[model samples]
Target: MTLAHQTLALQTLGLSKSFGGFRANSDISLCVARGARHALIGPNGAGKTTFINLLTGVVPATSGTVRLLDEDVTRVSQQGRVKRGMARTYQINQLFADLTPIETVGLAIAEREGAGARWWSRVGQNSAVVDEAEALLTRMKLGEVMMWRTATLPYGKQRLLEIALAMACKPKLLLLDEPAAGVPEDERHDVLDSVEALPQDVTVLLIEHDMELVFSFADRISVLVQGQLFAEGGVEEISTDPRVKAVYLGEDAHV
Candidate 1:
């Protein structure tokens, strides 16, 4: 493989998916470089979610290939992909309301270590796991409420915890689906800061409708329109592209 290929954290070739009579994703070939902060944006029905599902192996593609860290993972199961260093957070967090952030993250860490079966018995007893969970939660800006029940924390903190849970797997590629969705305006900054502060070694692919977050966090951007790639470029290029403004971003959109 070429050095260029070696540097890609994720790549999809002609990746497409369909359900019954509907085509949710067309043939899409995209690349995300190692440690790159890439954003995928589109209109409401532009199929961004379906594309994320395909990447995470939550939904199988009708055709095409998915490669994670340069290895073919097109046929890998969702759990298989996680084992191979690919992790994702959903648009709507799937957190355990009754579990504390520490417990949630601790279980994730244990699962990554192949000790999930004994996680309940080992959570507090395993100093290594506990330490790592604490450290991860703190990094995600949930240190102050690490012991609070998830349902009681603010929405933004809950979102941060979801990211923290994904991080526990030590993934090479992290897919964040709308980390700022449903957050109060005042609390949005916490989500932004936590995402920006993520380690450079962990490449991030963000799918968000919030333009402000996309512009702030993404160095590279891809605009998907009607399930096909409409444009791809650096932030300035996309922000200034007149066609993008016409179709997705309103004419009055404040780039």
Candidate 2:
């Protein structure tokens, strides 16, 4: 493989998606470098979610190719993508509300370690799994609430738990869809800190409307508008560009 291919965590060429007569994503190409902090930002109805779904194989593209670690995975199923080291969090966290953070994360780790069928039985019995889960929860700032039921934890903490679960997958590429959405102001910082503290070897593609998190977390930013890639550049350039500002202004979205 060429150096360029080796260095890219994700690459999409003419990636498009359509639902009947409506096009949710147009022909668009995007590249995220290995271990890069990349953010995808756009106004509501900009098809950001659709694009993310396409990347994760949650939804199939109308036409395009998705390359994860330079391997064409356009026909790969969602489960297949995860097995290939791609993991993601939803805008609305899908967590086991009844389970404690430790149990939840431990199960995820066990699953990754191929012990999922015996997850509950191995919880405390497996020292390696439990230890790894504890360390991941601590890193995500959930050590204090590790034993609490997920539903009882604060929204921000629940979000952190979701991230911790994803991290347990040991993903090479992590897709975070609006991690800060619905989080209260006071709790937002913790979420941001947790994101910023993620392991550098894990490439992050954050899809968020919160400009604060976007600017703070992304080294590179891509702007999507009406189902197409409108702009892409370093944080400074995209934040200061008049055209980008205009697009956000029209949608009453903060840049």
Candidate 3:
């Protein structure tokens, strides 16, 4: 895909993050093309999560600039960033236990559509919000079980629901922190399929360790090592990079 005309969904220039004296991410420069599926891959303790935290404003960066759709969002607060069309799902599930799938999605849609002020209004009576939630669930293929409590769903399904919630926000860019992490081997394909099915308009930046899923979904892949970007290229190029193979890919160097 030509990114020349598409605006950047996210970009970081000279980004650095530190915990006390140790740098978690240093001088990281990357750009995700608008609507592109970009992946960040590194082994554990490689600071992948820390970089994500800095981007999402969960942790402040020690230095650098973050641009989201041409707006400087480096120091933007999380909720403010959400309102600015950036949304993310945690590596671990963050859903409310008691809320049903429909209720959870309804809340997300309401938040995005600015209906929270009248949240006391009946759930069923809120036609616009309810309809939006229903449509989102239907698109996710979860409409039939929309009334089931989130806690009752299996781990993989819960992950899909989290993605559904992020979608409800109608984000211009979605940051997925290991959407396939922890799922059974048999169910990983389904989770990846659901992610692949999202609207092309929603650009995705994912941090994942699963090479197969990363290669299958990402249009471009960035390999990070020791808080620095080691390489950036398409799947084949990243897979064949000797530096990347020596560091992360390991024994399966030719993947």
Consecutive 10-residue window with the lowest summed lDDT within model 2: 115-124
Model 1, residue 53: C-alpha shift (Å): 0.5
Q: Each model's TM-score?
A: 0.95, 0.94, 0.93
Task: Report every candidate's CA lDDT.
Answer: 0.92, 0.92, 0.88
Deviation of model 1 at 54, angstroms: 0.4
Task: Give the winner by TM-score: 2 or 3.
Answer: 2
Candidate 3 per-residue lDDT, tens place, 75-188, comes to 889888999999998899999999998999988888777887684677778898888899888887778778998899888888889899998899999999889889887777
Q: Encode model 2's per-residue lDDT on 1-255: one tens digit a residue.
A: 589999999999999999999999999899999999999999899999899899999888999999999999999998789889999998998999999999998988887888888735745798999999999888889999999989999998998887888998899999999988999999988988888889899999999998988998899999999999999999999999888998988755444
Q: Tell me how far the alpha carbon of residue 99 in candidate 3 is from the true structure, in angstroms, after superposition.
A: 0.7
lDDT, residue 146, model 2 = 95
- Which portions of model 2 miss their true places by more than 4 Å? 119-122, 251-255
lDDT of 1 by residue, 1-255 (tens): 688999999999999999998989999999999999999999899999999999999899999999998899999999999999999998998999999999999988988988889735745898899999998887888899999999999888998998899999999999999998998989888888888888999999999998988898999999998889999999999998888888775667544
